[model samples]
Target: MNYTDEEICTQYGDRPKDNRGAVSPPIYQTSLFTFDTFEAFTHAQLYERENYVYTRGVNPTTELLEEKLALLERGEKCKCFGSGMGAISSVFFSLLKSGDHVLFVNNIYGPTQQLLEHLQNFNIEHSFSNGDVESDIKPHTKLIYVESPGTMLMKVVDLRKISTIAKKHGIYTAIDNTWATPIFQKPITLGFDLSIHSLTKYIGGHSDVVGGAVVGTHELIDRIFTYGFQLNGSVLSPQDASLIIRGLRTLPLRMKQHQDNCLRVIQYLTTKEEVLKINHPSQWKGGAFSFIDDQMTGYSGLLSIELKEGGFKKVAAFINQLSIFKIGVSWGGYESLVNSPIKENNELELIEQGIGTGIIRFSIGLEGSDLVIADLEKGFQALHSIKS
Candidate 1:
């Protein structure tokens, strides 16, 4: 049955027998489950998803999380993993062969680029495109991967256009939908083959847990489950799965607040003289918004800002002076976080991706808009104090 996002959260994982009539799902923490007889054991082995024989293969708690995530993303099934990269690597390893090629949209996650480079050792080939999906296709291309409101720069791509192109060549399409989440964007409904998420981020809704999920057809997910997930051994813990389930219950409310806070932050950012550019979908003009604008219901807390003038020293000063916003790596939690795209040795890579050294990415949190704005004001004050 088709359920709204809010309803899906409250009711999707509710099983009276599984939870012993408790409203919340209980964590199946045991490593292994016992069967009454040899025939029962054989049935368990044969129908792995239907019956849980081992925690690594499947656990009741983790399976509940998977079911909810699959429904949220409008996919047939979902497989949870220990981390975001775990789910992503499983997809690549399961679907692509030694001779296959992959075409990636520009400004993907750094680790993803590194993963593609590592795949070269096994004779896999990959190419990057700056939104030119049609022109980038190669004869050996088996997959097309994209991240809308892409990593660092927040560049929005036309997913439908990419999906159409992939379909012409009989290729699969996968997207990292962590930024938008299922509440705002439904990639599978828009013709994507798979939708992936870093459940540690917005889906987890807290800083405590780390996990990932891949949502797609039963056939594809089963293949990944049997071949890649089992072999990689990146199983999510039952405890963490339960936490994610708790997070799911509040996801819709949290996301709405995130959107509201972010829009307010962007409004304040526009008034700053030092703010040169804001990379967000809401700011996309003309034809750029024609496709994506309609599909996405709202934006998340993640956004990028390019300063008018700054180098590493000024950048360091700005980040150091901020009190409310923590200088951290990952975002999409309860607290606001800030980061610079440029690192000690990765300046060239940032430049190659069209991300400037002065650009700062902000992950707006649940903090009030006034407080977040004041914190940024102090950051900019520190930036201005430093000599260019």
Candidate 2:
């Protein structure tokens, strides 16, 4: 029987059958599969092509995660990878070529920008879509890559409008939808050709595993499945895929608590005497960062806050003083994390986004809201002492 996407996800992503009686899906942890006969081997490998040749090509555990991811993104196909960068780089290499110009959004993930630089070093031309301008698209532009609510600073881009412009210019649109998970935003439904995710974040939920996924039209996925994935070979391990699958079961629940905590935290920050700015989408004036649109209902666990004075040094002091939030590089895990760009030479660039040296990015966790708030308040008290 054919199952609906939601039913398929519930059954396969989380709610497995009680035949074995285990609630969680078991990790296959296998590297290879065998066939019964020579004819069967040929059928699986060459003629019929129904068998798995290598773990790099496919795994049952990874396949389960891919199926759920395709359902989550409302796409026909999905590809899993070792990390978010793997997925993104595969998409780039699959779709782009030398001399093909790319219109990429500014304020994207740091690693992505680094990748683009490396691509440029390899002769692929790229242009930054620094401001909201469609006139920048050139005839050679082949792809428009965007990451809405990007990085430590939250900056939203009009995906639909950009899609229209890209279509007119014959450019394919792709997005790093990590900030707005599928539970809140579906980039495919909003006109993106491909949507990529760092499943290590919200999808993995606990931040125990590192993985990424690309979900999109069957045609685009087919190319990646055949060309990008086959050659570069950054496939997600079967064990990691199991972690993401298990995490999917609790995504909705965890995201709700994350939003609740962020709302309270952002609201409190807005009222703080020392806070200079808050970059949460809830505070945006109906631009790309505004979550009032139909594309998003709830915010993710991440949000950024700027202090009135002191830059990264004070932000670092506050972080060192914090008891609950750990200073880390990544977010979207069960625990909280905070970081800033205070030490970087790009401090002025971040400051341009209303983020100061004292600006601190917070990833809310499943911890009790009251306790989280008290911990943050103590950090703020420390910040005040630094200023005094």
- Candidate 1 Cα deviation (angstroms), residue 49: 3.1
Model 1, range 73-174, lDDT digits (tens) per residue? 889999999999999999999999999999998569989999999999999999998557888899999999999878988888888878888998999999
TM-scores, one per candidate: 0.97, 0.92
What's the CA RMSD for each of the models? 1.3, 2.6
Candidate 2 lDDT, tens digit per residue, 289-342?
453486676688798887778666677778888889988888999998888777
**lDDT for residue 92 in candidate 2, whole number 0-100:** 91
Kindly report which residue stretches of model 1 are placed more than 4 angstroms away from their true locations once superposed. 16-18, 344-349
Residue 284 lDDT in candidate 2: 76
Show model 2 residue runs off by greater than 4 Å.
1-9, 13-23, 47-50, 285-292, 344-355
Best by TM-score: 1
lDDT of 1: 0.90
TM-score of 2: 0.92
